[model samples]
Target: MDSSSLIASPSLARRSKQLFLGTRLKSEQLDETMLPKRVALPIFASDALSSVAYAPDEVFIMLAVAGATAYAWSWKVALAVAVVLMAVVASYRQTVHAYPSGGGDYEVATVNLGRRAGVTVASALLVDYVLTVAVSISSGSQYAAAALPALSGHEPTVAVALVVVLAAVNLRGVRESGALFAVPTYTFMAALLGMAAVGLFRLLTGTLPQVESAELQVVPAAGFEEPLTTLGLLLLLARAFSSGCAALTGVEAISNGVPAFRKPKSRNAATTLLLLGLIAVSMMVSIIVLANQMGMRYVDPHQLDQLRTADGSALPAGYDQHTVIAQIAGALFADFPPAFYLVVSMTGVILVLAANTAFNGFPVLASILARDGLAPRALGARGDRLAFSNGIVFLAGLAIVLILAFDAETTRLIQLYIVGVFVSFTMSQLGMLRHWTGRLREVHDPRTRHRMLRSRAINAFGLALTSVVLVVILVTKFLAGAWIAILAMAIFYFLMLQVRRHYDQVAEELESDEQDSVMPTRVHAVVLVSRLHKPTLRAIAYARATRPNVLECLHVDTDTEETRELMRQWQESGQEVALRVLHSPYRELVRPVVAYTAELRAANPRGVVAVYIPEYVVGRWWEQLLHNQTALRLKARLLFRPAVMVTSVPFQLSSSHAALQRRERDLDRARPGDVRQGRPPRSFTRR
Candidate 1:
């Protein structure tokens, strides 16, 4: 049989895969997969935008520890987060233009700082991306539970299911996933922004009403029972600001995904970054301001002990504490039930889709790492759909583990959230600073120098701000959960370094030398025979066709009767090759064959011993277990012998023909990415 006949066709599993992930795309369609600005905005910016659903709540939750009195600082904290958000956005605008190759912060750090620094940034971003999916999906699950009470205790399950769904959508291809996600992202924007506008209008017109929690009192925590001093208040606000900086989580995604954008990739990416910053900051500040205006009080969902009724008593038996956005939506659309549900439902949907940002960014980052030999090469290869499927599945698996580990609790996961992002943020800003400084040195043109100087200033400010925020996050959250993220980053950093080292060592060891061009002195072919069957005869025929200096059939005397019968059949059939038998007192088939091949190699040290073993090509998977047991074992042993070449001579069964036909049909079907990969469709006729 020809080599093509050995190929297995599409099975039931492949059909199921195609059913879920959609049809595979040819490589030439990669350009068609590039995203327009509209789709790219939602795909890359969803995490940042979706943070409005929870970031403001985190601010309120932190301040609520000091009782409702501390709520006065909520707007200021939101303002701080907004300022940081804008700075990050502006800094990354420079990044997309400077490093439009989609390396994002890692590329910047590696180029301007060093490989170690780049790896540091890459590690941080990788951890951050996993946390993004974890936090976003967990937060979304929380919102989902609030909307559907039946789902309250099942958030982890819901979160995992959501992760699986998102991964499947992403496996379809980047453009397809983006197109699917764009609507929900835009709906979230409109819903939240619309609620903000309406809330602001009501406040101006003196028609605004208090939220359901307005009458509830926020009881002080154990340490904050008394009034806080200035220092205490400063520490409290710092913690709140750090938690609120979740708004900045997805900003770097745009920089990392510049290559995915359509024409004018850099400009579109920068514009998307600007839009993300504006929309996110506006939504976040609006939610905080509106929550404060409506006398909204929120505590950690798990810490409901801190919340009390107007009577200062925990009297309610089944009172649900909805999310900050839910409360705001309820108040703003008190009479409009549909609008309220719309806002809340879309909030949940967007939070789930927010993880899509990580889905898009993580795989691209992993692929880049793979290309640089810092990650597994599989991560760098495009799947049937032209997406980094391995990286996508890997990220999903990590995120699901994190979600389960944290019990899909957003508050708990949020504590571990921003540390890695801020690490990447700080490193990226520092790298950009070095980048602009180096550019300024090279640019003699007056206009170019001026532009470079302006960019440098932006990066300088971003560096200063992000460095401060990183310090605050470490101080306020290290014990809370940020240490876990830091440790994870450290682990990833070490792993990537080790992977790169391994690849380098392998390349060095495999480097061609002058001796590689030399040929062996002669070929000594040996065919292993177990019985006088068609497969055994085929193996002998193939081995003889090579016209080796010496040809022989090797049989192990595992069973004396079988060996004698094989010799009788060999003589009766008048085979051309000489029959040789090795005695096996232990009744072992593989060991005797291995000993003979090693003896042959040792005898003719400069010559090669080629061992051809007959293998059955069975169509059914179960049929495989029934055949080729001895040949497999023998080949495994022979492979380690010096100057030995192991070859499988496949004898096709009738069942294998079915597999060959199926394989041919699959080959005839044109796949999506084939044209781009220079593999055009071709017809095949069975021989």
Candidate 2:
């Protein structure tokens, strides 16, 4: 058939098109769904920006391991972390330019390194994506619980619900969800940066107040009271830097989502990456500096005994310590309580929105992996909303599982978070170095070669810096729960390999062969008669309509009386087809039919056996349960048999007709603009 003729045929296209229209977007509408820079920033940068809320706490918490004596190094650690962030951002700009297809690290490593490198990057990225959702939402839920005491005990539930809601927004469409998230994202940036500006001005004017925790002295962990050895101090510093590197977790997302941006996708993505790095660094440094100036003390909540009063006595009962950001905001805005509340509220909202970046990045990366046969093919498909629905659901489900498992505690989850992201970061930069080296060999122009060389140098530096950070993270955090993330990465890596192997095996087995192209010798048809009802009659009629070589009515004698009555009726009705009954000693329904079909197929090895089973189409829930049970089992069994075709001839009952009419009414009731603008009906699937 010609393409134009196929398009014009209603019978061939209408039903199939209708089945998918509501759940899938048309190929032509893809461009309309592309995100602009304004919307793309929030969609792709929220996670990085939101990291500022908790990264500083992680830094201080690590320093608290050695007590208040080590707190002076917090700002220096933050500075080092900021420097690393700049290098990563610069490295990723080159990545986005080279790979504007939204593959991110996985693509960079695959093309420049090798398949194993690509799979490793993919596994790390997938794990990081799940951790981002878990940590972000969990932290957000923590802030929310603090704000509303009633929610304190239900943080995990709230976190899971936020994940579900975020998934729904993302499944709606990228541009649409981006637009929705833009408000809170922008609000958060403004609130945080504004707080920083106001607090800095207050400090310059000599009016800044100390934090509430400033009065409490932090007791050092055992053995830290004595003078520290060189090894101990170095390990403490490494631990602090590794913890602060949490701010760098989401920086790779912009590169992963380059294709989602409008025209000049690479340039736009690069610009967004720079903006993310600058904003995140600024916020993180500001928070860290502010915390230092206010003398904020952060420690594991379980180790509350480490905090003592000014007299070196223990704190009073129920002395709950707020987060570093929370303490800073409260101390900075002591007089203006509403501003503190605003900052707190926006911080929580922004943290939840931060997970949206993962929602955006994970699917795009998964789609790339799927295309490369490293993941399920379903992850590669776009839904009715033109988003990767399967990947989104998969990420959300994994995140929810993690949240529930960890009781929505950010501190615990954060330990497993940065390892994967940094692994991808270090490997990606190394791959970029290789990429630039290969490109330099092919380029002859002086200016272009110089630029390529400069880019290669930047990536080389990024590789060195991130490599150190990755080592530090593994060393400092390995025993402290980071091993879970490494184990998860290993699991995903092998699982993808298995999935790819299965897909390859299926593809090779299904490959066309000239020798196997010949037609069947003959077609033998069998109509399964469960009862002499309207459905059975319809099935028999449909089977006869096919006009096969030989036809017979088959029945399982599960009950002798019923079989006898059916056979008598067949004889009295004078049917041309003979009734074939197989007596079942065990009185089983599905097994007898399966055995008969297999026997017939074995007798005619070269012939095709087509089985027609009567199925009722009912509307009400209970009615549906009452029918199709036996037919479903028979079809399921016959589907695995070679040369056997099971066709369900559905006899629509009166309720089914009503249900069809109701569906048509719902279709007609769609938004007027949807029809007027030539858009198809939207799928009600919430992804």
Candidate 3:
């Protein structure tokens, strides 16, 4: 029944520890250096760019609910969403210029609207970060299936793995600088553009290969009927619009990461925003154009598998329909299958990297919010590599949970998408309009004032467009489960408000004054001694130095013999006062001692009760198991009561010395990668 045998089979424990914790990544691998614009773009903009991979798929999937005739409108919807994205991007460009402190929406809203609005914006962004992980990881898994058919049923596993990889890479160091990100980002844009180009060229040449799923027709779900009414069409369009809005999910990155760019950071960020806008628009429109051209359609495989040919013959029952990009890639790259797989694989990689955008942005925004006392202080600390590490790890953990919960089903997860992003989006745009107006009012120069006015107009338009989309997203997607995201945002908002209030109350309570520096009136020393041990002896000597009206050893007895022996010993020693023995028939020693102390305090309320307890200082971690009971519990309880000060008198045990030596030895040992490689510890850590 010893502590070591109970759970300590050394070989089994060691193996389990290695398997469960895995190998820790070295710190040197994660560089914390500043980034140039090239690296920053892919790091921060990957989410927006990676969104193209899934945004088109979501649009086509939504349109498929109403059959192929409804699919023709997909291109127009894509264009409309693109227009809004451009407007939002233009307005955020203004945001980066005016508010380059990295506060982004929270700052803009707080400055114009006040603290409540800032917290509201912060909450929305926090929830959006959760959705960003869920959406991006789910979609990434879907793409993974397309790229690697063998991994079809393993979506959640793959997505979780992807999250772990991204988290490790991010936690290693801020020095990732988007180096691994560049090719995938650029490749995704190129794949979409190339598909568009080749599709268009083949169309003009009358040689375009048909999409794989083009021959198959999507049967309408239970709701939609043939020859749909105008009202029904409008509702369907609204739903499609809501889904297409996923394209705008990553637009706020520039604002969130204004600090990450090179010199002239704001201007570089604005230009990058413009580039992001153009690239996103081009790819978004191209996918719709190509899908519309090739007669591609997608649907939630859970329903609507009842399609039959014109002759009433059903195609195979278990035929798998590829995604929008997959279908398009299959069609456009028919002459080049390698290109098809390349595009699909890269698309998947980029979608996972898209979450990396959230990874970078979430932590930074969290750190800023934490600095403002709106979040946990842990988030505020810049990690060793100078990144918001707490935020990154937090986001990664959340994404993994969501991925596992939803089984990485993009179809279901998309329902929770865009709610947070658009909430922050519309609020941020409105905040920007106020920002411009405020600037214009301060500036007397005609040109500068006019520029502010122009920016205001752009933001005003963006606010209107985004607000409309926001309303649509709420209305159309609410029943489809957008409510979950909205609820999450509300929870985050209120949680932040509560944290801020708690911090504010603590600050008010803790603020020091001149009275705090003065010494106490007198030091009363009361030592709690359960036995006449070395710890008790040390406490008695230490307490005697204080020299107060009350200097005595307090003991609680559940047994009569031990108390008599102690009393006999105390009398033999002739130490001034008799040892106080509090009775405990219930074996409740702490209560009796506490009551005695309270009785003493009632006689003298102005006096302090500084009760010192004997405690073991062990070297081996498991030594605490050998000694546990009333002492630890008594000290903890006493510390909470007002006017009562509890102190621990350390009595070192043999095990404590060994454990301390082990820790000291660890400090001198070379880290895993430091000696073998010239690079820092993090770089040498294997994937």
Provide the lowest-lDDT 10-residue window in model 1.
1-10
| Backbone clash pairs in model 3 (N, Cα, C under 3 Å; residues 3+ apart or in different chains), count | 12
Candidate 2 structure quality by residue, lDDT tens digits, 604-634: 9999999887766676555655544777667
Q: At residue 19, give the lDDT of candidate 1.
A: 84
Candidate 2 error regions (>4 Å): 1-25, 531-538, 544-547, 619-622, 668-672, 679-687
lDDT of 3 by residue, 529-600 (tens): 777767778878777776766777887777899889988888877776447777789977778877877776
Model 1 lDDT per residue over 242-336, tens place: 98998899999998898899989999999989998999988999999999999898998878989898999994777778888888888888889
Off by over 4 Å in 1: 1-8, 11-14, 640-642, 662-687
- What TM-score do all the candidates reach, one by one? 0.94, 0.92, 0.88
- The per-prediction tally of clashing pairs is 8, 2, 12
Instruction: Order candidates by lDDT, high to low.
Output: 1, 2, 3
- Judged by whole-model lDDT over C-alpha atoms, candidate 3 comes out at 0.78
- Per-model CA lDDT versus the true structure: 0.88, 0.87, 0.78
The candidate 3 region of ten consecutive residues with least summed lDDT is 1-10
Candidate 2 minimal-lDDT segment of 10 residues? 1-10
